[model samples]
Target: MEIGSFDAADASLKFGAAAEEAALNTNVVVVGSLERLRDAKDCHKLQRVLEASPDKMQLITSVARAMSAKKDGASARELYLLPEPVETDERSGSVRRVCLIALPSACSRHNSPARPHALTSCLKGNAGPGSLTVVAMLDDPSLAFATGCAIVRAFPTWVAQSSTAAKMQSKKINVIFDAPDNEAIPEAEIAVLSWAARAIRFTARLVDVPCNILNTTEFVNQARVVHALLQSTLQARGEEANAVSLEVITGEDLAAQGFGGLYGVGKAAAHPPALAILKYYPPGTSAADQATIMVGKGIVYDTGGLSLKGKTGMPGMKKDMGGAGGLLGTFRAAVGAGVPKKPLYCLLCLAENAIGPLATRPDDVHTFYSGLTVEINNTDAEGRLVLSDGLAFAA
Candidate 1:
């Protein structure tokens, strides 16, 4: 699933502004609290419908009471559908039918970040692929952004692993944030929210692919794609052409340059290993005299090398490169969002540890890029070997 595929917008919309109308005309309209519905500016019209029957009135009251006592972040209450749409306002216009989902306190405890996994259960059947409106009653844009991230996180449908590779598919759910009409939503906040959502989704997809589909060569290509995206994004802003560059070193180049740790760990794999570097030079500087470096382990798949892994231990080896995936995602988003006026560097150490005649043995002692000799007591500890070279390069 591609994160950037979704659309999100925060606008000057009131709390529960369309709840009554949406309940009668749309599929779903989510709200954070019951007070939003009970104390809405147009609640009288909704009150009349909710009070039409004693049972319905009791249900509404019960929900309000339950939500009032809810302390944990974002717990779901009983679902309620209104019998009719609210009386039309010439200024407000027509409303669509929707199911109202009320979330209790979200991130109210010590400013803790909202976790999408915690709230996924509450959102399962109520919201679907199309359009989802997250009404932030508290007037916190970060809350709205958090809620949007959760929505995107829970909405994507995963498929079974396949022999033939293809890009991950997402439903492209549209999310809208309804803030208080008096409040104004900032464009920068929206951009950050969108970028965050996309970056997370991109990382998840990267870690999910199998080693064959995302090996050393393929992973370097992926890094290159992020590099191109950063360059293009910078160029589109009319930035200097030399601002961003991506450099890759692999195979003989790694060995010749004394990257023994990296070369030894990956020499046995079908695809040659590589070290990918993404460099961002701020405007007006042609040289990167001193730069901050971020290093990531890109072990595409770990088969325990000469040490060998049991069947149970080998299944999820594809996710071994998670550090690299996260680094690339962050690099792409940070550059797109505009980095600080300093040289920024991201280094990826890419490799795959497989069993073969050419693989390094447990007793092998190899000299690393740092001029340190490491005795390979066990080849299963290859991640450290690759990282040793990466750390040396960064130093």
Candidate 2:
């Protein structure tokens, strides 16, 4: 039970890598309480050991073959999980990089900078207290891929809102049902399945929309449609999406906000710059459980300010608003869900790069809304400039 005695020799391993590497076989088994693995030094040892293996397989099984014949001998299993850890790719044996967790459930990765299952953080247990199994595997790692992503259970078999507080039994499926203790909400599967299709479509469409059609103004406009759809679910999909609250702040309005980063980037364009903001507040729940702010980096056109990008350097700068599209799509989902308790905020900063005398110059000392004066090192770096002011205002 002493953490000091245990070395986290297997701390860096991921499930897939642990399974794939025939030579570097490993699995983590912790004896005794959670307290033992919680120590800082012991955790370090576990990390080093997990990193030692080289496999990319998700559900890895290995046997400690050296033991003699016995019933409980090597068959018994113990499990441990590190909330977060960093290590190189034990699967491909590529350059070591900082991965998210110690044991990943399902990972699809490549040598590229953005790899799969890499960003995923496994949920070691179930939705609530002790009921969630401290098992050997992860539940759909891809479901919670990014930092802000979360898992939620949507529909229930039947509604049970009423309850007589004093007449409760020690154990029973209450008249009002949440998840009964110790049972994994099978709904995460169905709910995520429904969400996945749309998430994939949104991800793919936004990916294809090309930065040209998905600028700050367009992005905000699209979000307005999403808001309208939320207000009334019966609203038809395509054209109805266009009939929402579309408020675009431009010209002097954008300038008055002192968002010089957005203004500077949009100044060269014949079309005035735009700052777009959209909001959605669902009925009921006065305070709301939580409010999330979705902000996208909107670079309408990146001609590279004064430091122009050549043909090859600028092939896909148009898609710079990928983050914005992601945010808008997420809003669409929140709207589609009839339960609108929490208020959601969507902000998109937009601008196009038009080459003219007014265009910002390289090494230009552009002032940001946050009042941080950045030396314009490169015109092509305009994305960060526009994002800076947006981020500052967001703060």
Candidate 3:
């Protein structure tokens, strides 16, 4: 209906009388599948139009036509639309620049002339442009990466601060739907990957910053900004939440929890150790799906202790909370991405490793919140101690 000459041989004849009528009046939609690709012999038809068009390539026109004629969803739009070739062999003079788009669900079910293999076969393939987005039945519904994450890479450019992670992002592709609705899940999975890309990038930057710039208070303030987005009830409390909650505990409160590791580590710093907790419960879900308790070890800076590490070990110590960074990442994912209705609890324990007059001495004995006793062993191997308490609490 948008243009004219949409009728391809198969579609032109198969469309119910009504679709047939519409095809007669449309040009952009060539109501057929592979058959329509044959309209232009050699280079004068569709391929020529592709090589010489202004809008470049738009699938909408093609999709509408395919939809009108195919009896089933087989007519679902699948093809390539690339700004440049994805694969090429110069010696064979084979050059292909088009991006690929395929239906993973349907394609994975494809049968050869006589046999059908596993879906893994398709996924393991080169994954040409059209092949990346896919229909996935995620076995786990908790973590984003557990389900799948979208990774993207922008382009080639040299910058003093560029990271390998950033470079990986540039060439990144997305995972298809993994949603509540069976049909929409794959697409939803893809959408969440896109969302995480936007949200996680900022988190990476925040975690990468030096401790001097990003402190416990700063972390709390930023959390306030994020909480304001949905304007859900906020908490910096020490108790369970009514629904959505956030809590920060420190000093005597931590001591009462029997968190000796946290206390001992902080005795050396000007500020006491603080445990930040965030929780979100969805009314829609009766039983939380594999509720995950994510804990981040936010040691702002590490000077090692009685057995201090060299500068080389402490260089990127700013990211010592990388574990916590990942937790915050999961927390934000639960909030930003369309996480399935579930309760998520996050704990970010922050402290600074400083040499103080009251600093913990070598061989100091301490007990974790779980009542696990540990020898001062080594001062810097602190991430594991804090996480033990966090894990015990979460468990």
What is the descending lDDT order?
1, 3, 2
Candidate 3's TM-score: 0.53
lDDT of 2 by residue, 300-333 (tens): 5677767887889777776666676666666665
- Strongest candidate by TM-score: 1
Cα error of candidate 2 at position 103, Å: 18
Tens digits of per-residue lDDT for model 1, 291-347? 778999999999999899999998999999999889888887677777546778889
Per residue, candidate 3 scores C-alpha lDDT tens digits across 82-101 of 43433563232223233222
Summing lDDT over every window of 10 consecutive residues in candidate 3, give the lowest-scoring window: 1-10
Compute each candidate's TM-score over C-alphas.
0.76, 0.48, 0.53
Clashes of each: 8, 21, 34
lDDT by candidate, in order shown: 0.66, 0.44, 0.48
Tell me the lDDT of candidate 3.
0.48
